[model samples]
Target: MKDFLAELIEIPGGSGYEEQAAELIAKEFSRLCDQVHTDSFYNVYGIKRGSVSLESGERPKVMLAAHMDEIALMVKDIDEKGFLRFTSIGGVDQRILLAQEVTVHGREKLYGIVSTVPPHLQDAGEAQKVIKMKDMCIDVGLPPDRVKKLVRVGDLITFRSPLATMQGSMVNGKSIDDRASVVMLAEVMRELDRLQYAAEVYCVATVQEEVGTRGAVISTYKVQPDIGIAIDVTHGETPDAPKEDTYAMDKGIAICKGPNMHPGLTEKLIETAREYGIEYQISVAPGPTGTDARSMQISRSGVPTILLELPLRYMHTTVETLNLDHIKSGARLLALFIASLKEGWQEWLKY
Candidate 1:
């Protein structure tokens, strides 16, 4: 899982540009699933057939969605000095942009560093102010004519930080937001390979989730699954953050509950966790979860949906952190929930 995650995070798959990451996900799923394919929107789907008899009516289709896109930047303009000005592809914080190493996906992979006015050059009060994205530029060390020839105004840029293992089983790097969840889904697929199940599992690596839940909306309509589960990241407990607002790290997976999720399905997930003795934390999402689950719930007469999250610290930054143990636990919980689905499971989805 660590090695796979390391490779997965290195691929630059910003919201609208996810072909490279989607292809990699599809290839991994091909090894574990009976059939795999990518849709027109670049959403990758891998199907694991159920062992139930054809006489048992159509097997319930279960869709497990994990977005492959991450927060990134796009070149919005180029200065006369050959520096690149960029805009956020997703919800990026301007506070972390200074001196960050990034790779510009232009005509070629160009290395660069995000730059701003150094503190020594700032005015007395200006030094304390936050640098907005509009005022920042990337130094790619190229001449204006040379840069214009190789890079365009709409090139993608991604953090160049490599995943590093920290003490206490924690891994840190960029894109752990959804890539960690993606790895958890992969682990679930591997677990299902050895377990008996009766539902058609559609493992989907969705695209454009950061910009909106567009990928999930289209993918759900295509699969038309009886159930949908969105795997994402939530806030992890940090020293400065309120304890009540964050989840415990390395302890368990967070099972979300509230308007966006089907209450019955959420209950079933909690019950399954208890039955299997898997540790889990409850997350109260009173409104749209800002995840694929939000869009998935309204798909085609409403699909029963649930959201599962892995606790992450320093989200949307290059040094996002996650514990491997929590990922394993999340995968086991999902695999158990899927394996526990039996005949008449649809009836349980009713309010």
Candidate 2:
């Protein structure tokens, strides 16, 4: 999972530019699925046709969706001094903007950094102040003419946070928000290909979720599965963050609930975790979750959806941390869930 995540972070896929990431995911799913296809919106859906005959008239096809896009910045302008000014394409904490090394997408890799004023040059009243986007600029050490030729006004920029080994079970890198979720599905697809489960499994890798969960609308309209499960990353509150409201790493997957989640589906997930003795946590959302489940649920009438999140620290930042054990545990739990459905599926949903 550590190596898998690093490759995804290296790929420059922010919102509208998901082609590269989509290609890699599609190729992986194609190896496991009976049939793989992509919609006009670039949502990759890997289908495994039901191997068992359905007596429920129309068996609810299970659709597992994970967004492939991550939050990043877009180049707004270039100054005469060869510095690049950019703005956020998705949510970002301006507090952590200074001195961030980033990669600019172009024919070649262009390296730059978000600059901060020198301490000696700081004003007395402004010494302890937060800088806004307008005050920030990315310094790409290049001549003005050369920088103009490579970087344009509309290029994308992502944090150049490389994945590295941490503690025995931990992995730290950028974009762990949902990349781990996507990787989990990749492993699950391989298991599904081997198991040949009873339900029609749709492994969908969605795009543009960082912006507004756009791809799910198109993908769900096409697949229209009975049950939709969106796998994503959740805030793992640490010492600096409120523990009562957040989850922690190495505790396994956090199964979330609330208005966006299907009541019956949420119950089933917790029950499955307990029955198998898999480490799990309960998360609650009071409103529309910032996940693909929200989009999947409201698409084409309605669909029962549940959100499963992996605890990650420092979300949408330069470096996001996650536990590999949690990733494997999540994959195993979801795989067992699909297998358990064979004996009698809808009976569990009835309550």
lDDT of the candidates, in the order given: 0.91, 0.84
User: Candidate 2 clashing pairs?
Assistant: none
Q: Model 2 segments beyond 4 Å from truth?
A: 193-196, 347-351
How well does model 1 score by local distance difference test? 0.91
What are the per-residue Cα lDDT tens digits for candidate 2 across 214-296? Answer: 98888888888888999999988789898777897777899998999989878888888899899999998999898999999
Minimal lDDT window, size 10, model 2 = 342-351
| Runs of candidate 1 exceeding 4 Å displacement | none
Clashes of each: 0, 0
Model 1: lDDT of residue 86: 97
lDDT of candidate 2 at residue 176, scale 0 to 100: 77
Candidate 1: which pairs clash?
A: none
